[model samples]
Structures are given as C-alpha cells and as structure tokens.
Target: MRAISIPLPGGPEVLTLGEHPDPDPGPGQVLIEVAAAGVNRADVSQRLGHYPSPPGTSPLPGMEVSGTIVALGRGVVGRSIGDRVCALLPSGGYASLVVAEAALLLDVPDSMNLVDAAGLPETLATVWSNVFMLAGLRAGETLLVHGGSSGIGTTAIQLARAHGALVATTAGTDEKLAACERLGAVILINYRTEDFVERLLDATDGRGADVILDAIGGAYLDRNLNALAPRGRLAIIGNQSAARGTVDVRTLMSKWLTIHGSTLRARPSEEKAAIMASVRENVWPFVVAGQVVPVIDQRIPFAEAARAHRRLEASEHIGKLLLIP
Candidate 1:
C-alpha cells in the first residue's frame, strides 16, 4: 500500500510518499481502503514533531478518513464488508489503507461524497463532544467560537445556530469574519484589531456569551473570561498559543465560571468510541439534512501531504484542507 510517512521531526520536507505494509484489522476493527483524509492542526503539529502519536499508535499524521470497508475484525457486528464508512482515527489516515474501530465508523450520508465525509468526522466529533456533551450548550442562549474561520469553529457556529443559539465568532480579519457570517454566525469580531470582549458584551447586551469554544489560549485567556456571562462554560480544545498561560483565580471565582481543557487523542479508546457514538446519533442527521456542511478550503492529491502540512502551518486557508488518496 502507498502511504505518506513523516520520517523525522522538521519541516514539511520530512514527509515522504512510498510503499508500506498494509495494516490489518484487529479485534473490533475494520480495514478500510482509504479514499480521502482530513488535514488538521494536530497533523501539522505532528509533522513538525511537536505532537507525537501515543505509544503503539501509527507514526503517520491523519486523524480522520473516508473509505470503503474491505474486512471486519473479531467481535465486530452490525457493520459489514463493503460499507462506505468514514471514521475518526487516532492515527494513520494518510495511506491507501487504514484500520478503524467499528463503533467509530459513520455511514456517509447519501448526499455526501468520500472527500467531504473525510472532513466531517474529526471536527464534528470534537464539536459535538465539547460544545454539546461536555459544555451542555443550551438553546435560546448565546455562544462564542474563537477562530471562526477554522474547520471546527465554522461547524460549531452552524450547529449552535441550528439548535437555536445566537452565535458570535472571533477571527483575525474582515474576510474571515464574512466567512463566519455566511455560516450562520450572528456576530463577528475581528480579534486582530478590536477587542473581542467588548464585541461579545455588545452583541449580547452586556450579558456575555453563555459558552465559548476556544483554541487560542495565551493572549485570549483574560479576554475570554471577560466575554463570558455568569455561570458560563469555556471548553478549551487546543492550546495553539500558550500551553502555560496564567489565569486570574479571582475572576474565575467571582463569575462562577467553568473552564475545561482537553485533547481528544490522549483520551482512552472507550471514551473516543462514546464520543463517536454520540456524534452519529445526534449530528449525523444534520449532515444528511443539509443543516451542516463540510467547508473545504483546499483539496490536493494525497502524495502532496507535505504541501498540505505547509499550508496549515502558514494558516493561509479557511475551513478544512483535504487530501484525496
């Protein structure tokens, strides 16, 4: 099988395309002939050798994949061979073939193709678990998403809007704000120039957002707390800025706010399976019904995985970058 491997920790130049042994299905797993894969920020970090794969996991950098099931492993039922499934993978998605847990597999809607399906699993699973499951985002409330032009942020905006929440988004430019608005964001703030804290208060009439999906951690810390209403929940999914940002305990106590931080890859397999199950039950229909869509920024051939990594590191594109294997 043809696979793209990152041989060393460095620039995008470290990635190489060549033949590797095809991975086989293990217990409760399914072997998929990969068609398309999603490129994520985690992949970029992994390529640069900042984020390493967990022990016993594949060294390649792909988090989600869409493909056809060729075989099922032991104890796998309810799914069969030849199913057109897209799944959230812990690792090893940048190849002609990869294995996924059967429970993590999602049936691609009839309306979606393999490429779009590839873009859905990772972002959708993360948003569904963090925003709805963990944060308990309620209807008739206000929600703010940081990095609104991102794949996760764009999906979060649309989903929160669909569920009757007023959405606000923060990005770096007017063009990115426009993209966020087109995807159902009710308010947009250019974080690079203006203060998002003031905009959030202005949009919500001084009440602040009920919940926030934040990826930028360092400089946005105090401002994010300022933008939250009393009893607001802040779910931190990524630490792109500062992994060791200090927080004011007094602000947290006075506001009665809840700040949560997590990384999906470090979680146990059973927990990830549960997240996938919840996404399938609650979020899959939204995709099928067209209430949510994969916002693709670029689609390049799989062998150009190095270029894809470079594009993401430069932060030049909005929404998801996909590779067709």
Candidate 2:
C-alpha cells in the first residue's frame, strides 16, 4: 500500500508518499480498497505535530474514506465483500488501503460517485453530532454557522435548512458568502467587512440565533455569546483562530445559554458508532434524495497530498477536498 508518511513535524512538504505494508482487518473491522480520502484541517494539524493520532490507531493523517469492502473481520455481521461504502476512521485514511470499523461504515448509493462519497463521512458526522445531536437545533429556529464556506459549515447550512431551521453564515469573502447563500443560508455576513454579531442581531430582530456552530474559538467566543438569543446553544468544534478566549459568565447566566466544546477524532469508538447510526437514520435520506450533497472543491492525487494540506491551510477551498488513490 502507498500512504502519506510524515517524516517530521513541519510544513506540508514533510508529507511523503511511500510504500507501506497493507493493513488487514481485525475483529469487528473491515479492510477497504480505497477510492479516495477526505482532506481536512485536522490532517494539517497532524502533519505539523499539533494533533497526534489517538493510542493504537493509525499514525496516518486521514480520517474518512470511500471504497469497496474487500475483507471483513470476525464478529462483523450484515456486511460483505464488494459492498460500496464510506467510513469514519480514527486515522490512516490517506492510503490505498485502510482498516475501518464495521459499525462506522455507511452504504454508498450506486447513484453517487465513490470519490465524492469520500468527503461526506467526516463532515456529516461532525455537523450531525454537533448541531443536531448535541445542540438539539430545532425546526423553525435560526442557526448561525461560522466559517460557512468550510466543509463543516457547508454541510451544516444544508442540513439545518433541510431540517426546517433558518440559516445564517459568516464567511471571509463575498464569493464565499454567495456560495453559502446558494446553500440555503438566508443571512450571509462577510466577516471581513461586517460585524457578524450586529448583523445577526439585526436580521433576527434582536433575538439572535437559536444555535451557533463556531470553529473560530478565542477570537469569536465573546461575540458568539452576544450573537445568540436567550436559551441559545453554542457548539465549539474547532479553534482555528486561537485556543484561549475571554467570555463573560454573566452572558451565560443572563441568557441561560449552553456551550459545548467537542472534537470528532478524539471520541471513543462506541460514541462514534452511535453518532454514525443517527447520521444514517436521519441524514442519509436527505443525501439519497439529493437534498444534501458533499460540496467538493477539488480532488488531488495521493502523491500530491502535501499540496492538499497547503490548500486547506490557506483556507482557499469552499468545501471538502479529496485525495484520489
């Protein structure tokens, strides 16, 4: 198997495509012949030595993949060889072959391209777990998604809209904002020019958003609280800006707000399986109906994995990027 190996923690140039021993399935796991892998910000963080793979997991950077099952482990049931599927992985997705847990697999419909399916698992799991499962975003409520053009952001916009929630988003550029708008975001704010807190409040008649999906951590924490209505829920899934931020406790007390900080990669396997189960039950139908689609920015060759990292780090992509193996 050919996989991206990080010789050292540094820049994107450190990711090297090299031969590796093919990994085999273990108990309750399956081996997949990879068609493509999703590129995410976490991959870049791993390459830079900031986020290490969890104990006993693959040291490789990728976390999601689409492929055909070639082998199944003992105790795995209801799955077979040649089944088209996409899976959430703890690590090791950026390879020609990967070992995935059977419970984490989601069936890939024949109508969808296998390569495009690679981009869905991670983002869908992230958005579904954070926005729907944890935050409990209800119908008729408003959802404010920060970094609205990102993989998580794009998925959140569509999913929220499909669930009957009003969508608002913050992006850095006009083109990105327009893209978010086309994805069903009714309120689009250019963060580079407009103050999102003010815009959100003004658009909602001073009630603010009912739920906020924020990736910009420290830089936006205080403002995110201000942008929420009473009893609002804020889910923090990433800290792309900075790790530390100051927030007023009074805001939480006054508004009875809820804040949740989470990460998909570090979660336990059982928890992930539960999340995937909910995603398959609730989100898969929308996907099958073509109401929710993976917004792909580009697909790069596996050998050029470093270039993919650079693109993600520069925030140049409007949605998910894929690595073709």
Candidate 3:
C-alpha cells in the first residue's frame, strides 16, 4: 500500500508518499480500502511536530477516512465486509488501506459521494462531542464560535442551528463570515476590525452567549468569559494562537462559567467509541437528510499532501479541504 509518512517533523516537505506495509484488522477492528482522507489542522500540526501520534498508533498523519470495508476482525458484528463506510481513525488515514475500530465506523449516505463522505467523521465527531455532549448546548440558547471558516466551525454552526440554538461566529474577514451565515450563523463578527466580545454582547441584547466554541485559546480566554452568559459553558478544542494566557478568575466567579477543554485523538479508546456511538445514533441521520453538508474548499490528490498542508496553514480556505487517494 502507498501511504504518506513523515520521516521527521519540520515543514510540509516532510510529508512524502511511499510504499508501506498494509495494515490488517485486529480484534474489534476492520480494514478499509481507502478512497479518500480528510486533511485536517491536526495533520499539519503532527507534521510540524506539535501533535504527536498516540502511543501504539500508526505514525501516519490522517485521522479520518472514507473507504470500502474489505476485511473485518473478530468480534465485529452488525456491519459487514464490502460495506461503504467512513470512519474516525485513530491514525493511518493517509494510506490506501487503514485499520479502525468497528465501533467508529459509519455507513455512508447514499446521497453522498466518496469525496463528500470523506469529510464527515472528524468534523461531526468534534461538534457532537464538544458542542452537544460536553457543553450541553440546549435549544433556544446562543452559541458563539471562533474560527468560523474552519471545518470544525462550519460543522458546529450547522449542528447547533439544526438543534434549534442561535449561533454566532467570528472570522477574520467578511467573506468568511458570509460563509458562516450560509450555514445558519446569525451573528458574524470580523475579529480583526471589531471586538468579538462586544459584538457578541450587542447581538445577544446584553445577554452573553450561552455556549462558546473556541479554537483560539490563549489571547481570547478573558474575552471569551466576558462574552459568556451567566452560567455559560465554554468548550476549548484548540490553542492555535497561544497555548497559555491569563484568565480573570474574579469575572468567572461572578458569571459561574464552566471552562472545558479537550482533544479528540488523544482520548482513551472507550471515550472515542462513545463519541462515535452518539454520532451514529443522533447526528448521522441529519447528515443523510442533507440538513448539514460538508463544505469542501478544495480537493487535492493524496500524492500532493504537502499542498493540502500549505492551504490549511494559509487560513485561506472557507471550508473543509480534502485529499482523494
């Protein structure tokens, strides 16, 4: 099998396609013949040495894949071989073949093509776990999102809206904000020209947002709390700008806010399985119904993985970017 592997951590040039041993399914796992893999920010971070692969996981960069199941391991049931499935892989998505736990597998919607199905697992899992499961984003409440142009942001926007919540998102430009609007985000704030906290407060009629999904952690910490409603919940998934920043505990105390942070790939196997199960039971129907769709900005061949990394790093894309293997 051909897989993109990084010999050392550095620039995108480190991502190279080469022949590697094919992976086989172990107990409770399944082997998929990969059709496409979603190129994610985590892949770029892993390439640059910031996000390391989990212990005992493959060293490959990809975390999600869409493919046909060619083999099934022992203890796997319900799904069968030759099924068209997309799955959240712990690793090994950059290859032609990947092995994933059966519980993480999802049946591709007949309405979706291979390229589109490739884009679902990571974004859906992220949104379901952080926004719905962890934050408990209830209907009629306000949800504020940073990085509105990102894959996670787009997915979060649609899911929150579909669940009957009011949504707001912050982007660097109007173009990106407009994209968020198309996905049901009502309040759009250009983080560069305007203050997100002030804009959010104004849009919510002086009542801060009930839920906040933030990728920018360090510099925005204080402002995020200020933007939250009383007893608000803030779910932090990434620290793209700065890893550490000071928080005003006095303000948090008065507001009675809850600050929760998490990463998907680093989680324990059982927890990841639980997230996948929730998606299968709750969100997968919405995806098949076409209420929320994957917005792909570009699709590059698997051999051009470096170019995919460059585009994501540039922050020029408004939606998900993919790699067709």
Candidate 4:
C-alpha cells in the first residue's frame, strides 16, 4: 500500500509518499480499498507534530475516507466485501488501503460520487454530534457557524437549514460568505471586516444565536458567548487559534450558556460508531435526497498530498479537499 507518511513534524513538505506494508482487517474491522481521502485541518496539525495519532492507531495522518470494502474481519456482521462505504478513521486514511472498524462505516449510495463521499464522514460526524446531538439545536433556532465555508461549516449550514434552523456564518472573504449564503446561510459575517458578535446580535434583534458551531477555539470564545442567546449552546471542535482562552464566568452563569469541546479523531470506536449511527439515521436520508451534499473545493492526487496541505493551510479553498489514491 502507498501512503503519505509524516516522517517528521514540520511543514507540508515533510509528508513523504512511500510504500507501506498492506494492512489487514482485525476483529470487528474491515479492509477498504481507498478511492479518496478527505484532507482536513487536523491533518496539517498532525504533520506539524501538533496532533498525534491516538494510541495504537495508524501513525499516518488521515481521518476519513470513501472506498469499497475488500475484506471483513471476524465478528464483523451486517457488512460484506464490495460494499461501497465511507468510514471514520482514527488515522491511516491517506493511503491506497485502510482498515476500519465495521461499525464506523456508512454505506455510500450508488448515486453519490464515491470520491466525494470521502469528504462526508468526518465532517458529518463532527457537525451532527456537536451541533445537533450535543447542542440540541432545535428547529426555528439560529445556528452561527464560524468558518462557514469550511467542510464542517458547509455541512453544518445545509444540515441545520434542512433541520429547520436559521443559519449564520463567518468567513474571511465575500466570495466565501457568498458561497455560504448559497448553501442556506441567512446571515453572513465577514470576520475580517466586521465583528461577528455584533452582527449576529443585530441580525437576531439582540437575541443572538441559539447554537454556535465554532472551530476558531479560544480566540473566539468570549465573543462566541456574546453572540449566543440566553440558554444558547456553543460546541467547539477545533482550536485553530490558541488553545487557551479566558472566559467570563459571569456571562456564562447569567445567560445559562453551555460550552462543549470535542475532537473526533481520538474518540473511542464505540462512541464514533454511535455518532455514525445517529448520522445514518437522521442525516443520511437528507443526503440520499440531495438536501445535504459534500462540498468539494479540490481533488489532489495522492502522491501530491503536500499540495492539499498547502491549500488547506492557506485557507484558499472552501469546503472539503480530497486526495485521490
């Protein structure tokens, strides 16, 4: 199997393409012949030695992929070889082959492009788990998604809108914000030019958002609280900025706000399986009906994985990027 390996923690240039021993399925796992792998900010962090793979997981950096099952391990039931599937992985998605727990795999419909399916698992799991499952974003509520043009952001916009929530988003550029708008974002904040907290407050008549999906981490924590309505929920999935932030405890207590932080990569397999189950039950219908779709910005060749990292780091692309193996 060929994979992009991070031999050292450094820049994108350090991602080396090399042949690795083929991985076989273990108990309750399945071997997948990869079609495409999703490129995410976490991958870049891993390359830079900031996020290491979870213990006993693949050292290679990649968390999601779409492929066809080639073999099934013992104790794996209700799945078979040749099934088209997308899987959430702890690591090792950037390769020609990967071994995944069967419970974490979702069936990819024949109608959807297999390569594009690669982009769905991680983002969908993250958004569905944090925003809906954890935050309990109800219909008619407002959801303010930071980085609205990102993979998580785009998925959040569509899914929230489909679930009957009003969507607001922050992006750095007009073009990106426009993309968010087209995807159902009603309030667009150019984070580079405007204060999102103020804008969100104004747009909601001072009520602010009922739920906020924030990836900016500590840098936006205080403002995120300010942007929320009373009893609002804030789900933080990434710390793209500094990890630490000072919070105003008074505001949190006064408003009865809730803040949650999580990462999908390091989660236990059973937990990921539960999240995937929820997604399949609640979100997959929307996907099959085309109400929710994977928004891909670019597809880079597997050998040129470095280019994908560069594009993600530069923030030059909106939506998901894929590596074709």
Pairs of residues at least 3 apart in sequence or in different chains that clash in candidate 4: none
C-alpha RMSD by candidate, in order: 1.1, 0.7, 0.9, 0.9
Q: Could you give candidate 2's per-residue lDDT for residues 1-325 as a string of tens digits?
A: 9999888999999999999999989999999999999998888889989999999998988999999999999999999999999999999999999999999999999889999999999999999999999999999999999999999999999999999999999999999999999999999999989999999999999999999999899889999999999999999998998668888999989999999999999999999999999999999999988999999999999888878889999999999999998
Q: Can you write out model 4's per-residue Cα lDDT over 182-257, one digit (the tens) per residue?
A: 9999999999999999998999999999999998899889989988999999999988897688799999999999
**Lowest summed lDDT window (length 10), candidate 2:** 238-247
**What C-alpha lDDT values do all the predictions have?**
0.88, 0.94, 0.91, 0.94
The parts of candidate 4 lying over 4 Å away from their true place are none
Error of 1 at 284 (Å): 1.1
Alpha-carbon deviation at 248 in model 2, angstroms: 1.0
For model 4, the local distance difference test gives: 0.94
TM-score to native of every candidate shown: 0.97, 0.99, 0.98, 0.98
Report the C-alpha lDDT of model 3 over 1-325, residue by residue, as the tens digit. Answer: 9999999999998898999998889999999999889989899889989888899999998999899999999998987889999999878899999999998988997778876788889999998999999999999999998998899999999999989999999999889999999999999999999998999899888998999999888888889999999999999998888668778999889999999999999999899999999999999889889998888888889888889889899999988888887
Per-model tally of clashing residue pairs = 0, 0, 0, 0
Model 2 earns a TM-score of 0.99
- Winner by TM-score between candidate 2 and candidate 1: 2
Candidate 1's residue-wise lDDT over 133-244, tens digit each?
A: 9899999989999998988998999899888899999888888899999999988898878888997898788999889999987667777888899999999998888556
Q: Flag regions of model 2 displaced more than 4 Å.
A: none
Whichever of 1 and 4 has more lDDT, that candidate is 4
Model 1 local distance difference test score: 0.88
